[model samples]
Target: MADRDFLLWPFLETRHRDWAEEVEAWAAANAARLSEGDTDEAVRNLTRAMGEAGLLRMAVPESGRLDVRSLCIARETLARHSGLADFAFAMAGLGTGSVTLFGDPALREAWLPAARAGTSLAAFALSEPEAGSDVAALSTTATRESDGHWRIDGSKTWISNGGIAATYAVFARTGEAPGARGLTAFLVPAGTPGLTIAERIEVSAPHPLATLRFEGVRVPDAHRLGAPGEGFKVAMATLDVFRATVGAAALGFARHALDLTVARASGRQLFGGPLFDQQMTQAAIAESAVDVETSALLVYRAAWLKDSGAPRVSREASMAKLHATEAAQRVADRCVQIHGGHGVVRDHPAEKLYREVRALRVYEGASEVQRIIIARAERARAEEAARCKPTP
Candidate 1:
C-alpha cells in the first residue's frame, strides 16, 4: 500500500485526513473495476460509482466554497488507485468550475447538482486547434443575438470528457476587448442544435477526449457563465483553483510508482540474490522516494495556500504542478527500469503507469508554461519589493 503518513501532516485538517482515508478505502475496494471495459465505458462507470460513493460531491461542493486541500486529497487518493478514475473526477470539477465560481444562481442550480451526483458528465471546452497553450489565441466566437440570446460558432479541441459530457463550459471570443480580454464563457449542453462531435482523439493513455464543432448553436442569455468579456477571467480562475490538484494527482502517480518499484526490487532475484541487494537498485528506489516526498510537499503547500484563502495561487500552483509532474515522470521512468522486462510488457502496472504519468506533464499547463508563470510572478514580486525600499 502507498504511504498514509502524509495524511497526518499539518497541511491537512482533521476533516481532510478523514476524507482522505475514506477515499482511499473506496478506491482500494473498487480498484479491480476502475479500468474495466473500453475508455468511454470505464469513465462512465467510474463516474457513477464515484458519485454513488459520495466522493464526487467533494468536486462540486454545496457550500459554494471550494476546499482546495480536499480537492488535492481526493485527486491524490483516486489517482493512486487509477489514473482514469482521477481523470473522471478532475474533469467533473473543472468543467463546472466556472459556473460554481461565477455563475448566477439559476445556472448553478441547473448544473451543479447533476454533476455532483455524476448522473451527468461535464467538459471544460477551452482549448482550440491553435490555442492550446495560449488562451488569447482562441478563435471560437460567441456572437450575441438581438433577442438576448447568443450564437456560438467555431470549434474546441483537446477537450476532456468531450463527446460524452452532458454539458460543457465553452470559452469564446465576444469582442469585448482584444486578445484575452474579449473572451466569454457559456454553458452549452450536449445535443444542442448545432454542436457536433468532430473527432474522437486516441491517446497513449486512454480516456474520453474529443474535438467539438459548434455551428450557429444558440444558447439563452441565462446560460452565460459570467458577464460578457469575463470569459478569460472565468477560465483562468477555474484553472487557478484546479492547477494544484493536478500536482496532487501527479504525486499520487509517483507514490504508486515508487511502491511498485520497491516491491519489485525486494522480491526479484538478481545476481543470485534479491534485486534489492544491488546498490544500483537501492539508489533508484532512494531517488524515487525523495521525488515522491518532495512532490507531496509542493503539491500540498499549494493546496494549503489556496484553501487558506490566498487571493490567487498562480505562482504556488504553477510551481507545484511543474515540480510534481516532472518529478513523477522521473519516478515512473525509474519504476520501469527497476521492473526491467516486466515493466515494458503491455498491461503491466509499471508500463501502465509510465503511460498514465506522461500526460500530466502536458496538461493543466505544461512544465514549460508553469516555468514561465513562475518566472513572471517572481519578477513582478521582485519589482514590487524594490519599489517599496523605504525611499533609501
Candidate 2:
C-alpha cells in the first residue's frame, strides 16, 4: 500500500484525512471490479458505484465552493487502487466544473445534482480539431438566433466522457468580439438533434474519449454559462481549479509504483540474495521514494493554496502538475526496470502503471506547456517587483 503518513501533513485537515481513509477503503475493496470490463461499461459502473457511495458529493460540492484539498485527497486515493476509478471520478468533477462554478441556477439545478449523484454523466467540450493549447484559435461558432436561442456549429475532439456524458459544457465562438473574447460556453444535453459522437478514441490507457460533432445544435439563452464573451474565463477558471488535482493523480500513480517496486525488490531473489540486497537496486528504490515524497509536497502545496482562498494558484498549480507528472513517469520507468522481464508483460502492475502515468504529462496542459506557464508567471512577478522598486 502507498504511504499513509502524507495524510498527516499540514496541507490537510481532520476532515480531509477522514475523507482519504474512507476513499481508500472503498477503492481497495472495489479495485478488482473496476478493471473487469470494457472501458465504457467499466466507467459507467464505476461512476454509479461511486455515486451510490456518496463519493461523488466531493466532486460537486453542496456549498458551490470546491474544497481543492479534498479533491486532491480523493484523486490521489482513488488513483492508487485503479486508474479507471480515478478517471471516472476526475471527469465527474471536470465535466461539470463550468456549471458548478458559473452556471445559472437553472443550469446547476438541472446538471449538478444528477452528476453529484452519479445518475448522469457530464463532459467539458473545449478543444477542437485545430485548437488544443491555443484556446484562442477555436473555430467552432455559436450564433445568436432571433428566437433568443443559440445555434452551435463545430466539432470537439479529445473530450473525456464524450459519448457517454448526459450533458456537455461546449465552448464556441460567438463573434461578440474577436479571438478569446468572442468565445462562450453552453450547456448542451445529450441526444441533441445535430450532435453526434463522431469517433471513439482508443489510447494506451483506456478511458472514454470521443470526437463530438455539432451541426446547428441549438439551445436557449438560459443554457449559456456565465456571460457572453466569458467562455475563456470560465474554461481557464475551471482548469485552474483542476490542474493541481492532476498532479495529485500523478502522485498516486507514483506512490503505487513505489509500493510495487518495494514489494518486488524485497521478495525477488538475485545473485543468491534478495534483490533489495543489491546496492544499485537500493539506490533506485531510494530515488523513487524521493520522487514520490517530492511530488506529494508539490501537489498538496498547490491544493492547500487554492483551498486557502488564493484567487489564482496558477504558478503553484503548474509547478505541481509539471513536476509530479514528469516525476511519476520517471518513477514508473524505474519500477519497470526493477521488475525485469515481469514488468513489460501485459496486465502486469508495472506495465499498467507505465501506460497510466504517461498520459498525465501530455494532458491538462502538457509538461512543455506547464514550463511555459511557469516562465511567464515568473516573468510577470519580476516585472511587478521591478515596477514597485525604489528609484535607487
Candidate 2 per-residue lDDT, tens place, 1-392, comes to: 67889889998899998898889889999855866789888988899899989999989876788888889999998888899999999999999989999998877887799899988998989998899988999999999999999999999999999999999999999988889999999999998889999999999999899999999999999999999999999999999999999999999999999999999999999999999999999999999999989999999999999989999999999999999999999999999999999999998999999999999998888899999999999999999999999997
User: What's the TM-score of each model vs. the native?
Assistant: 0.99, 0.99
Give candidates' CA RMSD values in order. 0.9, 0.9
Please, what are the lDDT tens digits per residue for candidate 1 over residues 1-392? 89989988999899998898899899999955876888888888888888888998778888787888999998998899999999999988998888899889888998899899888899999999989889999999999999999999999998999999999999999999989999999999998999999999999999899999999999999999889999999998999999999999999999999999999999998889999999999999999999999999988999899888889999999999999999999999999998888999998999999999999999878899999999999999999999988974
Candidate 1: lDDT over CA atoms? 0.92
lDDT (C-alpha, whole model) for all candidates: 0.92, 0.92
Please give the distance, in angstroms, between residue 35's alpha carbon in candidate 1 and its true position after superposition. Answer: 2.3
